[model samples]
Target chain A: MTIAYAYGPNPWPQSFWDARAAANFVCGGAGAGLVVAAALSGARGTALVVPLLAGLAIVACGLAAVFAEIGRPLRAANVVRNPATSWMTREAIVAPLLFACGVAGAFGSLAFVATAAALALAFVYCQGRMVHAARGIPAWRAPQVPWLFVATGMAEGLGLWLALAAFLELRSARVAGWLGVAIIARYVIFRIYRRGLGRALAAAPARALDAAGRALLWGGTLAPLVLLAIAAAVRTQPWAPWLLLAAGLCAALFGAWLKATLVLRAGHTQGYTLPALPVRGTRA
Target chain B: MTRWAMVADLRRCVGCQTCTAACRHANATPPGVQWRRVLDVEVGEFPDVKRVFLPVGCQHCDEPPCLDVCPTTATRKRDDGIVTVDYDLCLGCGYCAVACPYQARHRTPRAVFAYGGAPAKHEAKRHDPARIAVATKCTFCVERIDSGTAQGLTPGVDPEATPACVNSCLSGALAFGDLDDPGSNVSQLLRENRHFRMHAELGTGPGFYYLWDKALPEAAQ
Candidate 1:
């Protein structure tokens, strides 16, 4: 019988999902995060306007980036036709609903804001599933991927909210505390996800992924936590707002970098395999 | 109720790659795009090495991961079990490309010719413009099979209806027929030989079977 063997080091080309696709992940995570933060804060006036406009803009930009990656952009509308099976179709359906609800929420509809927040979470989840559905890629197919994305998206979104709050001089100890919790949750999930990857992946790719995971842990998760603690300690100081802003900025940038590395660099296809090979010292 | 299938007899195959050339010639596929390929795998250490030629393309699974992951509903499986892509409906997002464990799907962003500069007349005429930027893979020569069936011909029995690879296999290693029919050549081959479908544990239920000359130890006893 025919046997399968691992094809080579890298079976598929890296160009399949390029930088544009990575940008989509970053933008999607940030956009969903901002919407969730806005819903949580229930801010008014300039506070509301900043998140509403910025969130929608980032999400729209992410969609545009994905559009740029398609070979036939005109046929992209067909993506909504297979919601029964495709996560991409589900994402397409939820994204517009999130936008509409976010806009309505900004106009003072608390019901719409709540709906937008829920839809934003769903959109983020669908993004994770979109990656997870690639059964050929071991890293993306891990069960922990979606959870990691959800946690990271919320953390990044909350960090953006804090940055906006600092810029607008709005005081919300509750929001800052929630941001801290989200960052901590993200760190825990990131560790578990990396451990899962280490077990699932081959030696070479696993080492490479471990390197990227370490960077994400130090820069994306821990560094922001440190900055947030510093800001908390110096709350009475005049430069407290600046320190909070810096923490938020660092968190957001690191989240983006993490997603970019996961989607673009760490993404690899499952190679070919041959099942039937004679064991050493055994003759056929 | 015709469930199309293929059986490759590994014992008879000479690893000549004639099937590969025949498939390329029949399909007029662009350079670097091999709808069918014979992979030469060298197993064991250098002193006791054995070279085995494995022909792989699409397994044409019963539950195709590619079809399940296609966002555009472009990849479809016919009643006869051939998986195909509707180029018009495909967005070329490469989702199906990655979902395919078989590594069967391919997308060429730009057109290229075997020659450096220009495509030959026959090559230009045979090339499908719709498949340029979209995903494409082996169709099991559906057009020829369908046309032959309409003309009261059996695909496996008729050279005109059979796939290029099967038709051109000089060693009679490749056979194509309806697996549903007990009397079909593929079914008979499966019944008579020790055969296995690749990645069957993945629950793909692949239609392509590989037949080995040696029987299992238990079966031989």
Candidate 2:
């Protein structure tokens, strides 16, 4: 039978992990980043509650998507069995603790919120490692993949916070400044990742990542940075908060877009390559 | 101590896919899944071209990436060095599938018949519900190996004990035996001819070896 996916020098898009898998990375990373962003922004008590709970909810949603993706949902607990080697196991173990701190911080103290943020960071790190563990997928196994995930998660959270700040009526210019800084950092890391990847990726995903990189620069990075700058200049204006919200939305949404692209579009399996071909006439 | 391995004399493989057919008949894998298949690769320019029929499947690497990445501990390597999966324990998360560089692992969401509609009588009878939505792959005929050994038969020498693919090969391209046993057929072949393991630089220490040349000696091997 002619297979849709041919194992050859040219890599083929992997069919195993699909949109549901991408949803986990997208939602999970954003949620983890939001917690870290709130913590770094010095969100305390009442200020911490909204973002913390929201972040936790996002994380839960991501986990739920993953649960739905697995073949044997009843045996899902088995995923936690190999924490010693599998990063997915580590993520599962940490998820509940992260949720615990998130809930406690919702009605408890700032320390709980801070604890939640630390755990969130750990969860995101596990996600990065999880993707990296797929050695058969060349796009995922890059050493910088974990770093990219961590950076994107934090950026998404901070952006969400900046956007949420407008509604909370507890807007801070300092937080906006931090979001800008985070955006710059994320963009830098993304560039480095792409550069390191060079032409290693298959043609299709390489083009996709390049396109994402471009969008990330204009929509995810520069546009948001410019909006933040403009919003800061007109801080007293009635429409200033809206611009801040827009910038935050742009940053957060684009981070998600990047994650989605990486997971879904760039998930190409490592195709076969032979160092040397056997001569047809040879015999031992 | 018996490290089960296979040696593919690449020159001898005709790319006729007799092994592939035998494997499918033995395993009863689904329509899209081919646990053992040959990759016909052409090298060099058009005029100077040469083709090599590479028999590729689960390498059964010593340091199996699939085993380490399996979240549910479903994939395990045996003492005799055969990697097998416990379908009951597997969540079919596909992590191991993607972790395997050989692309040896496979998972299907449901029972897909060879024909479009309802399953044929034989297909329905052979359908393993436990295998549904779980990772499956070439087992190297572990059942045959274990049972045959219990019956006092050596795997490589005994037809009943050997893998169906090895037994079915018309070209005598495929050889299987204990790599640790230097006097074994595979070991003897390796000792006589230069060979290379696929993706060896990845430190997988693949159980599959390909003998490419007789002109090259054991020193090159």
Candidate 3:
């Protein structure tokens, strides 16, 4: 559907926040999710160490991606100055705290584990608000976006946990159960988020986003759940661990794809508008 | 203690785009980056069509969303209500660009010219290396306003102190003045004409006011 705007199309450049920005969202969200899942599972030794290190590395890479995106990377420390208003500032402030706690937690400190989990959640929430604060983009301005990010982050984290478990030959019903719950929550929240976006966006962008959302639901959300269900049913079989691994891979990739689309494709500036006047004319 | 404002009289404006040219010449902005441009809006069907030219740029709002979202504190609204960007502080993250509903902010990472090639002598002379990769927008001719006011001349009354867009307007559609002063040209114009601001519901309290030709039927009585 070709939607006609009264004030013409957006004159400014499209893709203001490009692939690099999308990478930031994908990595940061998944990393924070993994940290939270690790804290919750109480998986000690190699199990905890692997996921924690992987999560932190991904987040650090995301930060580097953002640094590369800025014109002046040398003056990036200025982002920490404005926590009272800017969400980007808040995210910068929380990231170091999250990393510190995660490192301390790895050394058998229960207090650090709890703190890391809390900080991870806060970091995820801050990323969500960063997108939400982009008031020009109708797709990002929805109130549900922040919550959607949180749900997807948790789901992605659980998916990473399962993948690590499968690789390490560690099988735990508690982790699988939590993964199921996280997937369900993410799926539900995504539905709500997509619906809100459809209403808020113009017809053309909305239709395109709707198709992306459907793909995510079927391939990302439901596929993972079905694989996990098969894993649960064939617990005694040799292929059960493989199925869990497949499900984990599917969920993590889906979360990454969703974040990429949100930041890169759905990110559109607010088209121009004229005052309410009864006029019948197309934009020149 | 002056609040800067602009009044674009729709009745007088002819879509010549002189204001756009004047702004470009004065600022020496690169290609594809227009700080000020007149939007040619054609209203009504072809049989009874009426073309209206709307001049648009940074509204310099009292409560600018761009200022609120700037992580580096680069965007700031001055005491006189003209919104400005500190190029040195801006990281060119484009957050302020995304926050502005007006789509006024722009970022040009690379240098490009009208004729293409190495930067022209004038372009190179005018270009500020600090401005590259940072957000840029209309400043309402702050340099002229400051210098002219310092010399004890009124902004709207004196052509030297006024913005290039307002000064170069051929049809005299654009008016710049202190809105806080009742005796100011913009204040008097506002009091006399039925003017409307774009996206007033956003609560940005935009300084740009478009003067309508006739009062609305509901507002007439």
Question: lDDT winner among the candidates?
Answer: 2
DockQ of each: 0.43, 0.70, 0.46
Residue A100 of model 2 has an lDDT of 90
Error of 2 at B118 (Å): 2.5
Ranked by lDDT, top first: 2, 3, 1
TM-score (chain B) for model 2?
0.96
Worst 10 residues of 2 chain A by lDDT: A1-10
How many angstroms is residue A237 displaced in model 1 relative to the true structure, after the best TM-score fit? 1.4
CAPRI tier for the interface of model 2:
medium
Q: Which segments of model 1 are wrong by more than 4 Å?
A: A1-10, A278-284, B217-221
Clashing pairs in 3: none
Greater-TM-score candidate between 2 and 3: 2
The TM-score between candidate 2 and the true structure equals 0.96
**Per-residue lDDT of B1-221 in model 3, one digit per residue for the tens?**
88999998877778798999999998888777778888887777979877777888899999998888889888889999999999999988988887787888888776666676678788888977777788899999999999999999999899999999999999878999999998999987777667888778778899999886445556544
TM-score of each: 0.92, 0.96, 0.92
Best by DockQ: 2
Model 3's DockQ score: 0.46
> What 10-residue stretch in candidate 3 chain B is worst by lDDT?
B212-221
lDDT of 1 by residue, B82-174 (tens): 998899999999888777767777787767777765888878888787887788888898888999999999999898889999999998889
